[model samples]
Target chain A: MKKYLMKGNEAIAEAAIQAGCRFYFGYPITPSTEIIEYMARKMQQVGGTFLQAESEIAAIYMVFGASGSGKRVMTASSSTGISLKQEGLSFLAANELPAVIVNIMRTGPGLGGLGATQADYFQATKGGGHGDYRLIVLAPNSVQEMTDLIMDGFDLADIYRNPVMILADGILGQMMEPVIFKEPEKIEIDKSWATTGANGRKRNIITSYNLHNEAGEEKALYLEQKYKGIKEQEQRWEEYHMEDAEYVFVAYGTSARIVKGAVDQLRKEGNKVGLIRPITLWPFPEKAFIPLLNRIKGYMVVEMSAGQMVEDVKLNVNGAAPVAFYSRQGGITPQPEEIIEKFNNSYHKGGEQ
Target chain B: MGETIFSKTKGLTNTPFHYCPGCTHGIIHRILAEVLEELAILQDTIGVAPVGCAGFIEKYINVDFQGGAHGRAPAVATGIKRALPDKVVFTYQGDGDMASIGTAEAIHAAARGEKFTTIFVNNGIYGMTGGQMAPTSLIGQKTSTSPYGRDSSQSGYPLDFPLLISQIPGAAYVASVSVDTPQNVIKAKKAIKKAFEIQMKGIGFTMVSVLSTCPTNWGMSPIQSIKWLQENMKNYYKLGELKTPEMLNQ
Candidate 1:
């Protein structure tokens, strides 16, 4: 393993290259453009292709084409840019194409701001675009996790033939941290499903259009089963100081980082506060909170959005304990001290059940 | 038994085309299939099919195909060709799909000089969507959308895509041909073959814009559609090569 102090976006790009990703298609968007820039500088040297597409719409389709051809491919965009990619993302999901998409999320409903935000939790976890589809969403709190999750993201994408999203935010994307990259794993994937020229086999066609009712139903059922399998097998999370805690904080990505700080400070003050950070935002790791529901008095959901993920936490808790939410929206992030205050107020007042 | 004089190209599948009667997309598909067969690259070619009537080309073509969203085939072809440079990559796009919603993708692909072939079918109307007015629809032409005829004051003039593509510095070959006649069909095949050959040579972006008849959309008989294309489209989209590698060398 080699250790280097790298920016979060740069580390993700390098990890993708190390993971055998050979094609990158992107259009410049703030907070995530560094990943594209890094790929442009390094992909060519590694005998890969990095293309700056005309638009985010075009970039994602390029990824669709490359991934359909059995090459590991990726793309990066910020909030509005990612929103622009939803159409192609839907197509990618329907085609069952494996691709890595990094959304270094910024605040948005529409061109909101360039600062960090977790507003896209709903968009990422739920189907962002048209149709009944889901992306395997991975949230990384640190630059190191950014590298690790991206490598895992590609593996999981290929294994399930689904799009995997590394859902970070501007903070994690811009922050510099020491990252250790292990030797690239050599992966041999079966090309039988790929559309890489017919040569000695039946012609391979990749498309999302299912005109017949029965065919569409079968496809949807197959995808539903696959998603269920993923939920059963791949839900990931990290528990910090949760063994004997009364109040637990649920967060992911940059909010998790800040929540950890708050938890540490509250523990030093003799408060029984802990954190449950979700790594896989899609499968949600609800099981992590299920067993702890009886032990914990309440769950404090901290986010960079308007309490989007709190709903999920509430569902997981399921009346076993109250779930309270505190959020800072439009690119403003709450500090550790602010979170502590919010927790104290909520914990003392009894969270909403 | 006597030797057969003619047979279908092996590059095409047994699946019958879904194109409407009198539509020219089948002719264009046949020409492309013949070219791929003649070059013996059917086993190594990957085609990008655009959304529209020709979106189902993958079903009829024997080579591997990636279906692209409406107007995004050029970008899709760029990705495929860039990822697998050893494979022959091409895109089959309609005029509405290419010149209208996909204008930026087409222009940028040509400007980047991505090594691929594009077979652009300009039928002057949207065939699959019930004869909507296309970006290539002629002035004063009437369609489902332009019920009172295409007024230049409202929708503007038709787009000359080959002329636009040829102007890009990255494009190595650009041609405008038609399938309106047997001789023109031969010339169109030659142009398609040249575009594929240039892609094989890695000579940068190449495109062949074939002026085709949309009898169903144009509200004309199959014979009248051909004659109308011969007279009207010929006046706007001039036939023959617009740019070639030799021109770039000069």
Candidate 2:
């Protein structure tokens, strides 16, 4: 367990190598390009694959091809590039291909600038592509966690035989922090369900083409059952000083880090503040937030996007407390001090509900 | 490795291939199989077949076959090759799959010099989708899509795939050959073999364009289909090596 100072992107690539990922296909995009570059340099050393695909579309399909062959495969892209990958992602999900997709998110309705933002929350957590499928979304708030979760993402992907996304932000990708790169535990490769080019036994076919209506419906139902099981097994969250606190700040990823710092400072100032950091965005810890709702006085939903996760929080809270949102758009990361100020402002002003 | 490799391509199980009588897909498929045999890499090879008439090539090829989206065989091949460099990878694509819908995928694969071979079949018309005008359709070639004969004022002239591929620095070997005659077919087989050899040496992207016969679209007999390919298509798409690995290293 040697600790190495690494940027979030580099840590993820290193973690992937440790996790037995031998295939990486990606196209360079802002913020996330470093992830691809890191893998590109490291893959050669490990006899792994590194391909800079023509586009995000091409890159993801390569992910499809490799993953279908029962290999640990992955691809990374930013917001706009990820948007282009929606169709392929849906196909991957529908086919139940075990692969990882890292989205170092940036702001975008279209091509948003290269800055940190959590604008992809809905897209990541709520089936970004046109399909009734849920990708296991892991939100990492630190470089250390980013590395750890990338390994976990691969395991989860293999376990569920589905795509797992590390819905990270540009801040996380660029920021450098000390990380202990642990040698990954040995895991057996499973290809019982994979389409490894039809080697005699039952002709392994990997496809999402369910032309029969009944067959498609049945597959969709089975996927729903898997999602339900995942919801029970994989929901994760962190509670910061919520035991006796009134105002609970809800956030995740970089926003959670900012909100955590804010809560730490506000608690010292004698204001009752706490943070709820969601690690798994898809199986959002709605139940964990339930115990806090009755104890908390007010809710400040701090995010880099405009009220996306805030809506989810409000819906979960269900009027247990009034919810206030503090957000910034187009790649701006909300500062710790700024988030603290919002918390203080709302706490002092009293109820507007 | 010394064992002769049989042709991997076959007609669909329980159904004959939908190709026109004497369509060159069967010929090109055999050439690819022959090359894979000569290289002794068929057992470890993965072939990506693109959408079009040849989209169901996965059914035909006995080796590991993965179907790719139209024009995306190259990209799919890139992935499979990159993931498993020890395994030989190739793509069998039709003109529509190689030229029109997938130009970007093809160009980028070549530009990146991905270590894979692409066997491109050009028959001047889209055979799968009821004989539509394809990218390689000659100027004024009539099809369902270009019923009035392709008017250059509206439709672009036929694309020269070998000429285009030659410009790509990443490409180690590029040649255009025809399956219209026995001699030309033999030459085509040699070209396919050479392309695979370049990939085996890690010589980057290799592509061979086979001018094929499409009797149903050309409205010709099997013999006339061959004759038409020789007379008209061959003149437009001359059979020769556009780029060789030796030329590239120099």
Candidate 3:
């Protein structure tokens, strides 16, 4: 492994190139522009394509075209740009094309701010686009994880014939950390379904339109079963100091990094606290909490949003342990002290029976 | 036994068209299929169909086809062509899909000189959506949306996309032809063939705007629609090669 100090956005670009991604289309937006700029400088050197599209809408559709041609393709954008891509994302899902999208999320219901926020948690996990579909969502906490998760994202997309999203916040996009660049791993992929000019086979048709009722229903059933398989096979999470913990902090992405610090400080103060960091946001590792539900008295979900991932935590807890939320909105992250203060006030004050 | 003079082109599938009786989409599809067959690149060609009456072209054209969102065919074609430069790539779009909602995409695709062929079909109104006034609808034309006969004071005049695209230096081949008569149909086929040939040579963007008719949308018979198109569309849109690489050389 070759180690280097790299920013999160640059690490992601390098990882994508190592993962065999050769086509990149994007529009420039703050906190996420570094990835595109890096691709612009490096893609041509690697014999790949990097296009600054007219808009986010065109960029995503361009990805759709490139992915249909059976190439490893990717695109990156920020919150408002991601919203513009919802239509193209829906088309990619409906056509069952494999691609990767990265969202370096900013604070927003609209264009809220350029700072970091996890407000897109609900949007990422709950299928931001129209239609009954799900993108395999991966949340990365550090620069290294950002690199590793992108490599994993491409594989998962091809394995399931679905789109995968790497959901990171502005903080992760801007932060720098030491990372070890792994050599490109050799992976075998079947291109039997791709539209490579038919090549003496039946002509390939990549379309989302199912005019008849039966055909549309069948596509829906196939996608539902695929989601179920993903849920069963791909739930990933990390546990810290969980053995004798009475209170657990449930968080993901940058919030999980903050929660780790809070858990360590609370443990030094003789509080039985631990952290549950979810790496895959869509799968929502419910089984991790199932066995420890009785021993854990309460779970606190720390997020940069008002309260989004808390819903998933509550759904997973299901009354086995009370779930509370501590959050800061509009790009303001909750400090470790703020999380600890909220936890002590809530759990020790008879907040959870 | 007599020699068979006419037959269905091998480039087309066995699927019958679902277009209206007087609509010219079927004619356009047949000519495009014949061109691909004549070029002997049907097996190595990928076509993009846009969101309009021609959206179901994949069913008729026997080649790899990708369905594009409304007004995004140029972007999609750019992707496919850029990814597989060795293969022939093209997009078939209607006026509303290209000239109206997708104006920016088409222009920028030309500006980038994306090496692909675009077969732009221009009728007066939006046929698939029940004959709404399109961006290319004539000044006095009346449709469902323009019941008062398209007033230039409110709705803008028709947009001549071929003329607009001809101005771009990146555009290698640009032509506007009609399908109203046998002579004009021959001219349309010639232009379509030239556009594909330019793409085969890896030249810059090429486009051919084919003037067609929609009898159902115009509330006229098939014969009436042809005559109406020739008389009105010809006056506004000049039928000839608007630009070519040869012009650039001279």
DockQ, each predicted model: 0.79, 0.32, 0.83
RMSD of each: 1.6, 4.3, 1.3
lDDT of each candidate versus the true structure: 0.91, 0.83, 0.91
Q: Flag the better candidate by DockQ, 2 or 3.
A: 3
Better of 1 and 3 by DockQ: 3
- The positional error of residue B229 in candidate 1, measured at the CA in angstroms, is 1.7
Candidate 3 is graded, for docking, as high
Structure candidate 2, residue pairs in collision: none
Kindly report which residue stretches of model 3 are placed more than 4 angstroms away from their true locations once superposed: A351-353
* Model 1, residue B248: C-alpha shift (Å): 0.8
What's the distance in Å from true for residue A39, model 2? Answer: 3.2
- Give the lowest summed-lDDT range of ten residues in model 3 chain A: A344-353
Measured as a fraction from 0 to 1, the native contacts recovered by model 1 come to: 0.79
In candidate 1, residue A163 scores what lDDT?
98
Number of the top candidate by DockQ?
A: 3
Q: Each model's TM-score, in the order given?
A: 0.97, 0.85, 0.98
**B1-250 in candidate 2: lDDT tens per residue?**
6886754433223335656678888878767776676666656777787888887766555577666466777877777776667777888888898899889989999998989889988998889878999989998888998999999899878889778988889999999988777788899889988888889889889999988888887898999888887779878986799999888877
Model 3: per-residue lDDT, tens digit, B110-215? Answer: 9999999999999978999999999999998999999999999999899999999989988999999988888877888999999999989887999999999999
